[model samples]
Every structure is written in structure tokens, then in C-alpha cells.
Target: MKMVLFLTVSFIIIGFVVVVSMKGKMERKLAFIQENADNHKNATTPIILWIVGTTFWGLVSMALIIGMFFMN
Candidate 1:
């Protein structure tokens, strides 16, 4: 139980750090897309994938943390 708690907390922290760190890069990508108006094929795939992945993991971590508290 302790290990599970630790892992979930670590995941949440790591995910937060990753999203914050990637903010600048994501912005740059957006800016590039904005400037290049003609090339619109899969221009936002990276940003979409990153957001979906992070959001999914973050929700899973939160669910685990909440479950542990209620189950115990």
C-alpha cells in the first residue's frame, strides 16, 4: 500500500513537471503552425498526443490515490 501510494504520488509529480517543461516547446510548435498557413497536415498531432497522454496518466494517478484512501 505504501509503495502504491508512493508510486502514484511520484507519477503525478513527474507528469506535472513534464507538462510544465513542455509548455515552451508546445508553444513554439503552435507558433510554427500559425506562421506556416499552407502546411496543415497533422500539424497539431504532437500537441494533441502530449495533452491526451498527460491527462490520461494524471487522471489514473488521481484515481489510484483516491481509491487507496477509500479502500483502506
Candidate 2:
């Protein structure tokens, strides 16, 4: 529970930092996405997309670890 909470907090902090740092620049990025949504359908093409994917995978892995604690 502690580790999971810690990780959740850490990711929230890190995600905050990423968004804070990219606030203004995100509009351009969104525009790019809108313009190239189909052209860049491949996941690896964008760093933000990769970050999002990794974040999601990390959360899933964390959830699995927590689930193990409940299983046995």
C-alpha cells in the first residue's frame, strides 16, 4: 500500500512537472496531432505518446503488483 501510494504520488508529481513545463508548447503539439493524427498513427512516432504509453503500462504493472498482495 505504501509503495503503491508513493508511486502514484511520484507519477502525479512527474506528470505535473511535464505538463507545467509544456503548458504553452502543448498547443502547438495538439495542433500537430490534429494535423497528423492519421499520418502518424504509429505509436512510437511521438515522445508524448510514448510517455503516455509508458505511464499507462507503469500504472498497469503497479496495479498487478498490488493485486498480488490481495490474491494470497
Candidate 3:
């Protein structure tokens, strides 16, 4: 309906703006990464750990929310 169309249009517009604005910065960042490959090697484990922990916490929070809704 109208809500879906609004969300679709908003998503497309925001995505287009973000991409257009960041295209140059993205290319620059990629070039920097390609030039300095060793600097980011140590971050993989920590990033993975953070993602896993965050996912677990998010699921737990979502379950709690659902439980509360059902309990009420």
C-alpha cells in the first residue's frame, strides 16, 4: 500500500544519495587498504567476536521483548 511505496521510495533515495556521496571516499579507502594490507590483520578476531556477541545479545533482547508482550 502507501506505506510500502513510501518505504521503498525512501530506501531508494537514501541509498542513492549515500552511494553518490561516498563513492569517492569509498575508492580512497579501498586504495588505502590495498596499500596498507598488514595494518588491519589484527582486527579480524576482535571484529568477529564483537559481531557474534552482538548477535547473541540482540536475539536475547528480542526474545525478552516477545516474552514480555506475551506475558502481558
**Candidate whose TM-score is highest:** 1
> lDDT per residue, candidate 1, 19-67, as tens digits?
8999899999989998995887688999899889888987898798888
Candidate 1 local lDDT, residue 34: 88
Residue-by-residue lDDT tens digits, candidate 3, 1-72 = 556456545655665575567557656666666688799665355445645655665565556545555654
Judge candidate 2 at residue 68 and give its lDDT.
Answer: 54
How high a TM-score does candidate 1 get? 0.83
What's the residue-level lDDT of 62 in candidate 2?
74
Question: Which is the winner by TM-score between candidate 2 and candidate 3?
Answer: 3
Instruction: After the best TM-score superposition of candidate 2, give how far the Cα of residue 24 lies from its true spot, in angstroms.
Output: 26
Q: Which ten residues in a row have the lowest lDDT in candidate 2?
A: 41-50
Rank list by TM-score: 1, 3, 2
Model 1 worst lDDT window (10 residues): 34-43
TM-score of each: 0.83, 0.38, 0.45
Comparing 2 and 3 on lDDT, the stronger one: 2
Q: How far off is residue 2 in model 2, in Å?
A: 25
Q: Itemize residue pairs with steric clashes in candidate 2.
A: none
**lDDT for each residue of candidate 2 in 1-72, tens digit (9 for 90 to 100):** 677667756766776676567656656666777888887655325657646865785686677667757856
Q: In order, what lDDT does every prediction score? A: 0.86, 0.66, 0.58
In angstroms, the error of model 2 at 18 is 22
